[model samples]
Target chain A: MKNATGIWALLLGLTLAEVALAYPSLAPAVFLLVLLALSVGKSALIIAFFMHLRFASRALTLALFPILIALILLLLGFLPDAQRVMHAA
Target chain B: MTRNETTWEGGGSPFAIGAKPLGMWLFVVSDALTFSTMLMVYTYSRLANPHWPAPFAFSPSIVQATVMTFVLLSSSLTMVWAVDAMKRDDRRKTVQYLSATMFLGIVFIVIHMREWVHLINDEHITLTANPWNQPLFGATFFGLTGLHMAHVTIGVVYLGIVALGTRMGKFKTDHVETSGLYWHFVDLVWMFIFPMVYLMSVKR
Candidate 1:
């Protein structure tokens, strides 16, 4: 809980790595995947450390993450259909 | 079990946190879904359009956004410090850290507005139309960033109120911690936004 500055530094470093990764001429899918993984890593650090969720009850974390992840997955499920409709048009 | 142990039937908080912070967590979940949907829509648009515009250049746009990210991350650190100070019952340092957080949030807003102006005026990228002729670019870019900026603006005001209340001996540790939760949520949203919207669209 006390390592706020350390967490902040890690977030900054990840951000810089994100930008550097963008500079490379990687494949689009690869670039997007890396960007997303790094972004998710940054978010996890912030949520766990900065928000003190790591110190919170396991019940709270359990109740929150599952629903959030499920909702995100539900939203993602529509992407293929969206593309299908666009292709038909 | 012992007297220290409580159960759901005993009318105790199963989450072991105050209602205020729990409420903030709920709000964070809802707000996160909103941003996630928007980002998904942006991704769909980007994938659908063959000529999606990558309008951000390295010199100004990316650099400005990186600085903004730094500012926001620094503000989150300040917010954490503020909450820590409040937990220790050092009201003076709590208010000081809160003030520092608010100042950094304002700095973030200023930088963001400047970037928006640069895009609108110099780059001719509006909410609906852009020189790229790929209108979804303008729409999604502005929509996501605009929503995030609005949150930052509101967070600054929210922190200001908390700081003033804490200074006047009105609010307590829970209040400061609750506000910090909101501020940290805002920072995390920007964590996703900076990469998806800005880094992905960086002009190569």
Candidate 2:
């Protein structure tokens, strides 16, 4: 099993990358993609290793993923409207 | 004597009381519903308002928030290690990992407080303040993030108690893994929140 230090290093590296990519020089769309990828990756790592989901039954693991998917669906569905509202306001 | 007074050293009834993990799962499910409702409200408000404010207009310091995210993430790592150590019967290592987990949780909460204070006192972005004169932005921002912060505070206290209890051997060996499940769930919620609340609106 991996130790906590390795996990911390991975999290730190990903976070620094996020901060660096937040600059305006980067394309906003590309930055958003990277951010989403990093967030999902970090989330998976925590859930699989820290949460012991990897060791848990398949049913339990499947149960958790749908809740996360629902959140993502909600975010994506509303984001466009949210952008329009901000522009209008 | 009451039936509850019966203590079987090693040969109790096969059907026992509620398992700790099952109890933890029930708590996690309830907590998940709370967050889901908040997120739903956030989505609904965003949909209704459309263009209430730009993300950067909020003036939250991205660097500080990102660092706090890392702290919380690292704490999750330590929490898992604590459980792993307990499974191996390494009490000292378990304590070490739990201590580290609790310390990181505290640091995250402290940084969160600093961010809130900076926003309220220096930035003057109160719950009543509206960007573009839209009241929904303030309400949604405060309501969603404030609710999440309350969870973080509760998690910190939970970790504190777990740390102290580990020292006193209050939890059986099996219970450590159960506690880890709850701690990890808390970390998972922050994973979503850090991006949605801090990073998502950065471009504006």
Candidate 3:
């Protein structure tokens, strides 16, 4: 409802930027970090604007996101094991 | 009891939104966790396998994926506009926007399947193996994108039903909004998948 066209434009620009960034030979870690940050930005815009989460109640937002983020972080804890495996290989 | 009843016994909506939309939001939350787990698995697999392949070339794969992203994003914008039209009680405009959204979704799926066929037929990438010799790349790539594609396919059918119901004076603004939530969620998932699956694997 808050003029999603602007948000759409921003999302498209971010996506294009991601493509252009991929063309460069950036370091793997740096490239990954930048891509993740840009993706988070795009997702935030989509959740806030298109999904109308921005108009949702603060209580609902609080009840929903924090726990979800925590669970996702917990899942991410397994990622370092992959690094260890890579080193061993 | 009336909706305005605000007793501690849960007589009213705590989230200040209707039950339907709230239910959809809960579903979105659960589904988000599912995708997150899959992505974690993908990242883990990629990192563990040092021979992970960045098989997608910019010519056909990345370019085609970019087009799919555009179509999906445009569908989301149209979905929100459909919700807006529904709120204004413009039933005709609502259906029109919804149809447009569905069309875009179909286009996205078509383009996506084309890319998949290219990979399978021309590039010899399957669910089990690929030219890169990293079987995990094919496994994770198809598993993730295939799951997301199924969602998009379901979403298109969901939007079709919502559109028909809205046109027949059955569904209301909340219904439109709920469907929009699902559509937008599908688009949001692509926001991550496009970059994680496609961009991160771009051929150097």
**lDDT for each of the candidates?**
0.88, 0.68, 0.89
lDDT of 3 by residue, A23-64 (tens): 888865577679889988999999988888898899789978
Q: Which CAPRI quality tier does the interface of model 3 achieve?
A: medium
Clashing pairs in 1: none
Model 2 alpha-carbon miss at residue B55, Å: 7.3
- Tell me how each candidate scores on DockQ against the true complex: 0.63, 0.30, 0.79
lDDT of 2 by residue, B43-144 (tens): 556444535454443246687787777777777777777888887888778889878877887887788887777766765566778546656666777787
Tens-place lDDT digits, model 1, residues B134-193: 888888888999999999999999999999999999999999999999999999999989
lDDT of 3 by residue, B1-204 (tens): 545665367866778899888899899999999999898888788767767888789989999999999999999999989999999999999999999999999999999999999999988999888877888888888999999999999999999999999999999899999999999999999988888888877787
Candidate 2 colliding pairs: A85-B50, A85-B51, A86-B50, A86-B51, A86-B52
| Deviating ranges (above 4 Å) for candidate 2 | A1-4, A25-34, A67-75, A83-89, B1-18, B40-60
TM-score of chain A of 3: 0.89
**2 or 3, greater by lDDT:** 3
Tens-place lDDT digits, model 1, residues A1-89: 45778888889999999999888777555676788789889999999998889989999999999999999989877766645655665
